[model samples]
Target chain A: MLISNMEIIPGKQIQKHFGLVQGSSVRAKHVGRDIMASLKNIFGGELKGYTELLQESRDEAMDRMQQQAHAIGANAILNVRFSTSSVAQGAAEIYVYGTAVILE
Target chain B: MIELTIFLVLMTLGYLVGQYAEKKHYQSIIEREKRLSGLTTVASRFPPPGKQHDQCLVLGSVVISVDYFKRFIAMLRNLFGGRITSYEALLDRARRESLLRMKEQAAKMGAEYVFNVKYETASISKGRQNTIGSVEVLAYGTALMRPRDEA
Candidate 1:
């Protein structure tokens, strides 16, 4: 299915709207990664491990959202948005939502 | 005591190294911003009309951890009821870096413009006292590209 963050895709028309679909994933950092992150904190640089972890989680969330849209017979997902929230001490939730639609 | 000495040592190391890294990152960010200035990004939802373009999602995200010195400064600032300048710079750097990375990705795809850009910030290590604090910044947008036949 086609996915975009814009409300309208250029050169295309929305044939039908399938309301909203959302997906979310909650993930926690492993102890080993947390230890490595603490070490990196001393020097105040980018945490590559955490970055990759979050990215992977976000991709998974988007994949799930796409699955939901597909199940509803939509061919495209538009106006997508992403949010991240820390639910617990070590866990974060990646949430994504969008309007499912059929484009022509 | 030895514990106090270790704290001082870590603070000093964090200050010196963190300052150097921030300076280097700013330099690179400035250079890349100038290089990619031609490809613009906007927060408007609608693209310019009358042109058929391919739309796709592009995003860049980063996780930046606080240094010992900055964290100490922020803690003290919390008590003083004043602005935490240390974190202001940290977050500024993170946001700019994330945007630059997103622009680079759009450039790779030969996208002319990025629209409906948005940013999401999350504190990854929140709610745990005395733990190292880190914030994750994610910037995303829809990249509009000229159709392949037109390109």
Candidate 2:
């Protein structure tokens, strides 16, 4: 399905609007990854393990959003947006929302 | 005396390993950013000027946590109310890295441009510790794919 964050797609026409669709997920760091992160924190740079965790969470959230859009028979999701929060220690929540629409 | 020794050892380990890892990460980020330079990313809500083809949503997100040593240093800095340079660098790296990741995703999808980019960040708190343990940064945008014939 075609997705764009803009209200209008460059080459596509919006035939119908499906209001808003959303997907969200919460994930916690694994003990092993946490240990590695702590070790890496001392010298301070990029935390590979945590980066992977967040990326996975975001992808899953996006996938679920796409599924919702598909359920509503949307050929595209428009004006997509993302939000993230740390729900707890070592855990994060990723939420994505967008307008589902039929494009032609 | 033994406690001091242990602290010193841990600090030293953190310093050495953290510095090495950070340097390596910066190198990799720079290289990847250069490689993905062709895939233009912009924060404007409007799309770039080009012959547009197909479009899709793309995102990149990352979570990073402070190390024990940095946290300790930040805690001390809190008392003095000056710049926490360490955490500053960490956040900067996270933001840039996440943006680069989004571009990489767009490129993988055969997009020539990524527009309307947005960013969100959250601080994950634990228990009673006022210190921030970890942070999550998300970057997302629309990837514009041009027609193969346009090339």
Candidate 3:
């Protein structure tokens, strides 16, 4: 629950090493977005479709990571990082990872 | 002369297509590599975190960066606009890869847990922003072995 930029909390205590937990999500948008984006390449407008896709994937991956942390009874996670990749021609993968830590 | 011109044109076209495919493929590989970066190996034995352990271990995490220059110029085309910039792609990959490397290191160290992790992102370009950057994410934690009472 408590998220900090640093590893050790200034005053908080942590206990029990939860096995390293991670979560990943795969997402895709209408090829329509790519088509529209190409057009925007000339007009230079926003790519709304990919934006929505990334947002959705971000939440999903975080949720999965949290669930894994919960199973380990971690009160919080540290050193969280995110990554993305194209899994296929049309799909993309988003992954999140961190060390699960709990206050004793 | 005609054959030479035709050959040049074909090469140019091939280069264009290859450029696009490379971005997609390379980014995916980096992401997968990040996903698997953490410790997959099981520890034979170790005390859990928060126990009254004497020996403490620390870990640092970092993400590898790919700045603009290193990527294709057209990817530069993707930068100024687009929902997803090529820079975002590289940063994302770096984040994943760095974390994986940290986890691997922690597992190797035989630490029960990695605590106090830190992430440091630098240009690695000396001072230029136009460069294909490197993100070094450092993860550090105190590793300790505790007695049964501490657990």
Candidate 4:
């Protein structure tokens, strides 16, 4: 359930190393804000739509990863990482992986 | 005939605009990389900070993709479905950035061998009818490093 790019969680004790548990999904986002984005581009600022999209992708991958961890009875995932591979024109591979271990 | 001509013109203009935006994004990334070339992160999860920070190699990062060039054409064609390449570079950058930060944090904490890693992506913005969708990927992992003694 807990995720950090860094291996060590400040306060939580790592009780065990789950060893290679993971989850993944293929995501293809919809294109429906190009007009507004183009306008936003002229105005110049952060695009909230893309931010939300990426965040959601992260959550979905994390959810799948957690399910895998839970199935293995792990409380924490360590050394988590993400990799991207182009599947097609708009589709992408979203993979979440880490060592599943129980923490005391 | 006039309406058809206008429609074609709109598509052409949109395509050109999309291509320009795509190129600009990469140009900015290159500029940022120049600033980040030698920088990195180090961190640890162990208690008592004496010599525990782990280290990781920052393999030169690259947000490699074809979207910059394809955006123009992608605009001309609609219903791209799930086959856009714009997100590739963005995802690559996010992964590399996360790794870089992890290394920095690891070193600061003095923990070697950051183990167990994970990454994720989401849509920060949606492409309009004229174009396709855009997304951001957040890549993260445990910054575990192998101790010098162990390595």
Indicate the TM-score of model 1. Answer: 0.96
Task: Please give, for residues A1-104, the per-residue lDDT of candidate 1 as tens digits.
Answer: 88899888877889999999999999998989989998988889899989989999999999999999999999999999999998988789999999999998
Which candidate leads in TM-score? 1
lDDT of 1 by residue, B41-104 (tens): 9999999998888888999999998888998888887777888888888889889989998999
DockQ of 4: 0.11
Q: Which of 3 and 4 is the better model by TM-score? A: 4
Model 3: lDDT of residue B78: 58
Better of 1 and 3 by lDDT: 1
Worst 10 residues of 3 chain B by lDDT: B39-48
Better of 3 and 4 by DockQ: 4
Q: Which scores better on lDDT, 2 or 4? A: 2
DockQ of each: 0.85, 0.58, 0.03, 0.11
Per-residue C-alpha lDDT of model 2 across residues B56-120, encoded as one tens digit per residue? 77878766666657777888999999999878867877788889888988888888788888888
lDDT of 4 at B18: 50
Clash count, predicted structure 4: 69
- Candidate 2 local lDDT, A1-104, one digit each (tens): 87678888766678999999999999998899878876665555557787778778878998999999999999888888888776777788888899999988
Question: Residue by residue across A1-104, what tens digits does model 3's lDDT show?
Answer: 64332355433567766756789998766768767644433322123455456557767987898898888788887656666655554466767787888866
Query: Model 3 residue A97 lDDT?
Result: 84
- Measured by lDDT, the strongest candidate is 1
lDDT of 4 by residue, B1-151 (tens): 9998875666555457656655575576577556544433323333234544333422112222223334544444445666444444445555655455544555565544444433444443333443333444443434444455766
Candidate 3 DockQ, CA atoms:
0.03
